[model samples]
Target: MAGVELLTGRAGASASALALETAATRHPGALTRIALIGNPNSGKTSLFNQLTGLNQKVGNFPGVTVDRKTGVSQLTPQLRAEIIDLPGTYSLYPKSLDEKVITDLLYDRGSAQYPDFVVITADASNLRRNLLLFTQLADLGLPAVLALNMMDVAEQHGVHIDIAALQQELGVPIIPMNARKGIGIAALKIVMAQMLGAPTVHFYEPEDELLPMIRQIRYYFNLHNDYLALHYAHQYRHIGFLSPDDRAYIQELTEKYGFEPTARQAQETIDRYTLINHILLNAVEVTRTERNEPYSNRLDRVLTHKVWGYLIFFAVLFLLFQAVFAWASYPMELIDEGVAWINSLIQTNFNGPLVSLLTEGVLAGLGGVLIFIPQIALLFAFIAVLEETGYMARVTFMMDRIMRKFGLNGKSVVPLISGVACAVPAIMSARTIENWKDRIITIFVTPLMSCSARIPVYTVLIGLVVPDVPVLGIFNLRGVALMGLYLLGFFAAILSAWAMKFLLKTTERSYFIMEFPVYRWPRWKNVGLTIVEKVKTFVFQAGKVILAISILLWVLATYGPPGKQEGAEQQVRTERQRLEQAQPAATHTPTENTFADETERLVASAKLENSYAGMFGHVLEPVIRPLGFDWKIGIALITSFAAREVFVGTISTIYSVGQDATQQTVQQKLSAERDEQGNPFFTPARAMSLLVFYVFAMQCMSTLAATYRETKGWKWPLLQLIYMTGLAYVSSLLVYQAMV
Candidate 1:
């Protein structure tokens, strides 16, 4: 306790002084490292954004794909700080992947993220439950601040805390602020700046009975403190860095000492709660004020109703789809025009295969991907609004009962919701579902959700069949079609989950516990950032795959086996000449009967059909033909396995190269395409068939790889790929045959 000294006994100043002392003693860098910790719904993300603005990015913690958001915050003019927003957790005891990341980072002295200071955020309205995490972090004795977020909601509840008394009892600066309103931020920064060079202090300790065992662990690990050693003692077996030898020794010592970590954790929680309740007796006051039950609770009555709730959700989804079609039309058209212009410009400048590569491969690929941006942006924007308003939690609550019927736990809703963004992260999020069977089932079916990756594919194909006409005088029928595709996916996921549920069995009980926050107006700033971040991630991440595949496809389409292209133009000209001459002189004029442009396109097609990728496509054509796919589409199917988003780019590259240099867009080129018999290649039946095919196909390798990592075996991902592919083939076949 040498580094700790109260600035004023039972007063407010000691909290600031302690932080300052801790920083002075231990602040080791020019940029003070601050770690943000909080419970779910405490507005930690909002606070992080307020602190760092757009200067933040999401990255993976070392060796784990769990997202770690880090950013730089200028706490004050004098203090520069780096902030890491740790995932929310209730305690140091790990239950999920995210929780494990926190426990591992905080307890490991060797970690770069083992912070010099911590900012523990809590919801003022749910102070009792939120404080459980705050008290646990305080025990680590790092220089820390307690931010009572959402003060407005607390005021509405007639809840008040004596900030001075809480500061004295908790021995941390108590900053009561509404993160959404930016209230108290300046004062919090000023206090944080003052504590930039403070020393760390021990504010909480274990019982005398456990101190002996903690000391032994500290000595054995050569650790700096008892808190770190105690964590190691409890979780040695699960600790990634601990050797088998280390785990064996810890196991032996714990058994010999008759130490029970679970029992110890239970006792600690009770003792801490007792201490906390006593402190609150002096530090907090509650009126038990009578007010209308929270709006969230009232709204949940209608929103979570068994029948009406579902109808409302579908209505919302239909509205979302209609917006995608309505709002995105103008922008999508502009994108198509821009791409056509670029393709025309590039095609005019270059010659031979090089011209095709630039115009057809690169520019066309770019055009296909960019056209979907508006639709993607709109989709995520609506989702963001839903999330910010807390409607999504209600969706989760309603869906939980349905999930239980499918062998999934309530927590599966998180992964399924996340899957809409991207399946890779969604599968990673599934780690939070503790039951092995439930987590595996969630992972298997998450990709079936209509991810943003599928937006381009769906919009492109759906437009071929579903017109943009308004339905019921207000809604876009095309949007209804899009929603139908999504519903198809959802139902497919449910059925898949049911099948897997019957196949995989576990002995552990399933449970779902969650707290819902009172509804608030959407934070527009956060909503904009959410959409921007999601769209940016999509463009850049998908761009890499598209670019690589486009280049490879260009090479495959441009080059052929020796002499393959030789006489191809001559052969096309010979056929056109014979046909033109055979027609009566009175039948047509020279220009009218000419097929020069068509002949050039035919030659290009013939050469491509014999080229490397085309030859491979021909090999796949027979396999995929029953699903209404030709050789060109077969090539796209093969490349789409790398990423489902690549389908548009693949089609763009394939069609653009074989097409005449007529400055047409990819969609126009596709629409104008014909079968060998001169019928439209993409009839409504074929379009619907392909759309159904993509909806069920497990086309992304990354999702499969993520599943492998999550399940620690290939069995699940392999089964997933097979099941989805089979479903896709059979569904597409039936649709195409019935429609034809």
Candidate 2:
């Protein structure tokens, strides 16, 4: 076979080659292809970061378990290269979709691009299990290098291996280094350069003593059935080879081979393990005793215990929710003030309708959406710390028993926890659960978790009603009340899942299988990157919708029904004339300034009352009247359907009319407002009712759309909408009645 060579390096390399006296020299850009493959938790990502730094993009594969991460790195001053980070997997048999990604890119015949070389990253502490994947990759006949990651950890554990011997046996170059500390990176780079310049090495099945045994097994299987040996051989030789087509083929082969295939698989697993064990024993040595650490396991003993585990979990959740409200308040206030200042500046700098639209509509709307970034960042930061500490897995394990009781999988905890950040990613994360029933149930209930979108609404309502009072000695009662709302969402999800269990019947049995990686110090770099990416995505995605809605709302408020503005001016002029006629001549005719002020007031009121949004509010008034909502409040509710955070901005814009004129805060504006009956509209009763409404409302369109896509039908999304909306309505009604 003719071999085609590709180069890997950083961005911005030349795309030309030079002919030397005895050889051809390719320019730097020709070397831009690097493939990253590794076992799960082997620090492959850290290496990818070191190589690519800030030059990477994340996207999903065409239709697979893999997230395609591509980046550029400068290998040499003259060469730029592209790097691909493949999904983490154990072996390459493709038991799951994530693993299939690596295998497909490597050997699939239909693939258009193939890596020039493969970088196999192995965990130093667990070399035995890690080496198994490397050996398999080597067998595929690709030019490969071994990256011995976490060398520091391996030394701390007193484990040692002769690098030269291991590299000789594997027929590859080995570089030992700590990816987290950036050690041995230079050596690894040099080795990569040498390997890329050298001739390609072809690896094939070794002719060993086991070959006879393999042949004998094949012969025995062939005698029993025609395609049995062929099928097993095909599976063993292919790296990333599982798909629906492969499954169907296996099913057909299974039926033909009968009972022998099952027996043969068990035998094959045992054979692989035995061979791997022997190799590890001969090639590696452990000089130190295993540490009897009690911190992690002892903590898990109580945290994952059958009973106390749940109590601790709930306590942690309560604290997290309370922190989301209490801790975020200071930053939120700063952001609100900053936005108001920007708006004031914009108004002063420009004039006309376009300026008004830009200031009150687009800028206000964008600011409203952007204000939630601090809260999202804080929430995700806390979650990252928990995950980095390795406690998240224990949470899943502990919740499994109780979750199973509610007909939800333990794995559902991932999505549910993530839902607090944003339902979009939380819904997507449900894909990690392999069981169809469990995945569907998790997706259906995930949005019920109070997402950050609801934070502004909750904050406004809670501030208005739940008075600040010390409770249980130190904790704030208002904080406790906020926690209760989040807990309510959690319980609601569990109850719904229990009902779903009885409603949807399936024969598939649930299985709980997860890895418990060794605890390590939190990598701040990774945590920072996660926070940045999540915040960026949220801001851009939500900003688009809020900006559009704000523009539409501004137009509706500015241009009322025909003749409405003229009618307001005429009414104001008539009122001034009447007042002048009744007063003494010494009072002097009412000033033009007074007339202009009266006209402005009348115009503002008329625009709001007759605007399209006002019409919508009037239409829904009867339905929401019982829930203690006025026409203005009703309009805010409708716009907030796009996102709960928009509620604050909607209320701000609506209540900004004819005010003390310069005050900007929503709370300040709301406090000064009064109804036609001369009572404050944001009464405690109404605030409590709105709070309850937001707690249970299904108002996020992105969530609804994601649900539809995941379930591949409208059945679940429709059910979610009906169920959540009904719950919100009933709950708000109850709260209003009790409070009143």
Candidate 3:
């Protein structure tokens, strides 16, 4: 009611008066906070997307790693609301971190993120199951509106609900919606502007046995609602907002009353469902209509078939990789040429150390990061489509049995698949796996799944070694090579998981229970948004690291200890003069220019070999030389410990220094490199060896930090770093030796 009045010029109020009132009432034109809560797959997020459009941003909730998506929605011309998409959960009683996040915020009224009003999205087709959480939230006495989503799906299933009757019976506003089609959004917004008061109805009353304890919790905590007090009793220890003194008092009271929270919570659920069943009787109608096997079920027969399922899944990945290589080529080339042109422009116009820093250090490093955007965007696009279509769930279902054999829960498949995007969140996602050992094992092996961060490294290396010719007149050889690297990472992960099965022991059993959402066309808007978000994250985040490292690297490579660089240049000049004098005039006439250019190149190379970076690389060379890496490559390996993708940026900056006027791409520079013996560096054997090394290496410090946070100790992350590094070293050595 207040929101409505603020939006319209009321009581003959002038426009200026309304503007003044708005500014004074809100937090200096702050957005009203509205939270969207629902069971999983209830079309909650779809509705959020519809409301927020391009205004959405993602962040973590306070101290937790679970993604918090918030956006601004204009509910009216004068009123904007900040929409918070809370994680989906079945009930308020927390089972996982995601579920805990929901209860934590809802129970903590003092928290800034606490919603002014809640929009509960319920599946019209599965009203009874969906309303269980709705009833729980209602008892918390929050002012809320219900969005009855999936009306079309309900109609197709021959289920009809009387919205007016349901609203009246439940004592809340109910708006019928097909969120995918953008229906009822306007109506929902209208109701939200005129939000209702907190519900007066008690959906579930605590029994007398528990009332005294609930009363005590309510009195001590200053909670206005009995359900909030009961939740504290059920989940006191896990509550984030509660202090040590609060928890201690609650624990003592629990002992005093001989209360069993779990049993009481179960009884509460049964009571709520019974109440929901009674309330739905008059408002719901089901028609018994004859129908063929449902479309989703019919398709799942083949998609989830024992043998065909595995083949289909692999074929999808194969096609995805093929597309990544085939479609991204043009954009990648454009980006590469663009960077070179800019580099050339800067070099030609400017003549100072500052110019050199911009051209060689900043531009080269950022260029490496930018060139891979097309490929990264494409990879994220494919992943988004798969998830949006609901087929990713089937992949999880099909992999359960296979995963169990490798000492993983079926849920482990999510993190492994997620790792294909990035390992940081993939490791965090392992919290969904309840069993301690299963979660730890998933965390251990996830980084081995080649993430998008490795794409630039993989693409550059694969192009150097693998031909672009088509395989079987369909698949590109380069594409297949890229896919092979990914598969190599995957198999390595599972095998490592199998070995760790014996090393870390646990008797606790694990179960993977998941729902299969109905297959639907991918939401192109959501897909596009995902692509933009992922690419932006890659460019900006990687750009920062690359730029810093590149500048530092340039400084190290450009100068050496006092007189060493100048002495090397002088020595090259002396050698060139001797060669020119010893040669015959007629023989030198045609090759004179070539001889001078070669002499200049030698001076540059000699100076680089004497620089600080080169010195350090030389120190590391003997350790890595058996694997076919030169000191330059050694430098990349050491610097890339910060991040795998930095290897490309490091190579870019390293190769750009003291170069000829001809601007070459990073790959071209690498290809033109020669070893001391006049043999080509990065031969197929060496390139493949580097590829295999990155496939197993724990090259990301952020991933290590994430693992440390998730596992709550340094022991696992340190072990992870050591084992992964060892695996990378041994595997690369073996590959290089066998091929060479």
Question: Largest TM-score belongs to which candidate?
Answer: 3
Worst 10 residues of 3 by lDDT: 1-10
Q: Candidate 3, residues 1-740: lDDT per residue as tens digits?
A: 22123223443145334433543354444667889999988999789989998888877888765668899998879768899999888888766667788988999886777777799999998899999988888888887788999988888777889876787788776888888889889888876765633334557778888889989999998999888998898889988878999999999999999989778877878888888899989999988546655678888999999999889988986677667667877898899799999999989988798998888778877776676677767766777788789897798789888898998977787678767866765675575565567888999999999987799999999888888898999999899889989999999999999999888865544556678888889889888877776666555554565556667777887878999999988987997799789978887877777677667667776787789877989998999999988787887887676568779977865664434425457788788777678677879999999999999999576677568766656799899999999999999999999999
lDDT of 1 by residue, 156-185 (tens): 887887777777777666788988878777
The segments of candidate 3 whose C-alpha lies over 4 angstroms from its true place after superposition are: 1-29, 196-200, 407-488, 499-511, 622-633, 639-695, 698-723, 730-740
**Cα lDDT of model 2 by residue, 578-661, tens digit:** 865786776455455554564465556556666766678889899898899878788888777666776897787677665654
Candidate with better TM-score, 1 vs 2: 1
Steric collisions counted per model: 11, 16, 0
Alpha carbon lDDT at 160, candidate 3: 88
In model 2, where do residues sit more than 4 Å from their true spots?
A: 1-31, 64-66, 94-97, 103-107, 194-265, 290-328, 407-447, 450-486, 497-512, 549-602, 621-630, 642-691, 699-723, 730-740
The Cα local distance difference test for each model comes to 0.75, 0.69, 0.80
Question: Which one wins on lDDT?
Answer: 3
- Report the candidate with higher lDDT, 1 versus 2: 1
